[model samples]
Target chain A: MRIGELAERAGTTTRALRYYESRGLLPARRAVNGYRTYDEDDLRLLQQIRTLRDFGFELEETRPFVDCLRAGHPAGDSCPASLDVYRRKLAELDALIGQLDAVRTQVGAQLARAELEAGAALPGGPEPRCELTHNGPTD
Target chain B: MRIGELAERAGTTTRALRYYESRGLLPARRAVNGYRTYDEDDLRLLQQIRTLRDFGFELEETRPFVDCLRAGHPAGDSCPASLDVYRRKLAELDALIGQLDAVRTQVGAQLARAELEAGAALPGGPEPRCELTHNGPTD
Candidate 1:
């Protein structure tokens, strides 16, 4: 199949296929007419690449899976190297989720505080209880 | 104050200040010697931008806060426009956190399944219960 057909069958774009090829992950042979040609095996390799990419794996991280498929493994994760990539990806996702969670907490707190302050500053609003207490007495 | 001093006081880099200036978010006046000059007010604006950036707000999103500060508000979030930005940022962060949570679940499942398969395929491993069930039916 040509690049377009392969990309279509893999549910991706030709540009993405070209990017994989450029990264040497999915090299295609040239036909006698000088057009890029791919076989069913190439389609399988591309599907593997696309699947990992959809899982948010970086292009470089997909290399091991692509190599495993090219090496005749039944599945991309059939190789130790591919399994290592999965472990690393899991860790990366965990760390990212942690960081985002922290940021989310801080942002939520800031928003709540700012909204409270804005509300308190409205013209002719009742004085906050804290202010009344602070002015009322010294012990 | 010079650009470097402004950046230092804001806990950022001169390069970043220049970038903000290029985007017209923090334009600085020129000194008589053709050097960039900023005042304490610029430091306040830069600090507001940096704080929001740390909170994961995009540069464009921080523009309203900077504008609010430049308009002589006591703080960046002292204006209705700044509060609007806060609301939008909160929504964006919530959506992103949801997406990341979904991805984390998927990646975790994939890792668990792959590890199970890998363990089952180990050399000289005991036959899985499903394999015994299939062979028993055949026999």
Candidate 2:
């Protein structure tokens, strides 16, 4: 298949496909016209690459994983190490969840503080607050 | 203050200070041969920038917040909207956390499946498990 056909089948852009080839994550045969040609197997590999990336594995991290499969999938032999990687990724997710939890608490506090201060009559002006207007500059 | 002194007071690296200036996030006045100069106010602003970043605001996001502060700390005018921005940031964080959680699930599932099947796997055979690892070159 041509690059476009493979990219479309894999639901990826041609640029990303080129990048994957450069990264050694995928291989393509060059045609007589110097265009890249891909087969059904390439489509499958590209899909897996996208799947792993979506799982948050940086391309570097994905290398050992690809190696694991290439080395004959030694079941329990390397299973424990893959388990550890999964657990580490889980811990990272937990940390991010904790950070977001803290942010939520802070937001709640800000709202409550704003309300209580707004109700009070002892100020020269209303209390200041952080508003999200303009969303800052786009450029 | 000197670069190290300013960095200490701002709780950042001298490199970061220079980077901020390069990104138009900070202003630096060159002195004599080459040293950068910063007053107490600049240090204070740097600290403020650090605080905002810690609270999940991007440098670009800080522009409006800085504008609000510079406009005489507009009592009740702008701060009210800051809560909304914070809420939006929290939402973004939540979305990211959700993605991490999903990845954790997928990785764990793949690992667990590999472990259970490792018992009967052949030495040179591909495990041919699920979608994540099955699409490699061996297939």
lDDT of 2 at B97: 60
Whole-model alpha-carbon lDDT for candidate 1: 0.75
lDDT of 1 by residue, A8-121 (tens): 998888999888888888888999998899999999888777666666777899899889888987677768898898788878877876777777676666667767777888
Q: Write down the RMSD of candidate 2 (Cα, Å).
A: 7.1
Runs in model 1 lying further than 4 Å from the true structure? A123-139, B123-139
lDDT of 1 by residue, B51-128 (tens): 777766789999988988888776777688888887877787677767767666766766666667778877767533
Q: What's the distance in Å from true for residue A10, model 2?
A: 0.3
Tens-digit lDDT track for model 2 on B1-139? Answer: 7788999876679999888888776787788979898887677567656766776778776655554454555332145555566566667766766665666576677766766566446465655655444332210
DockQ, per model, reads 0.28, 0.22
Model 2 bad stretches (over 4 Å): A68-85, A107-139, B1-4, B18-41, B74-78, B120-139
Give the C-alpha interface root-mean-square deviation per candidate: 16.0, 9.3
All candidates' lDDT scores?
0.75, 0.63
Candidate 1's DockQ is 0.28
Among these predicted structures, which one has the highest DockQ?
Answer: 1
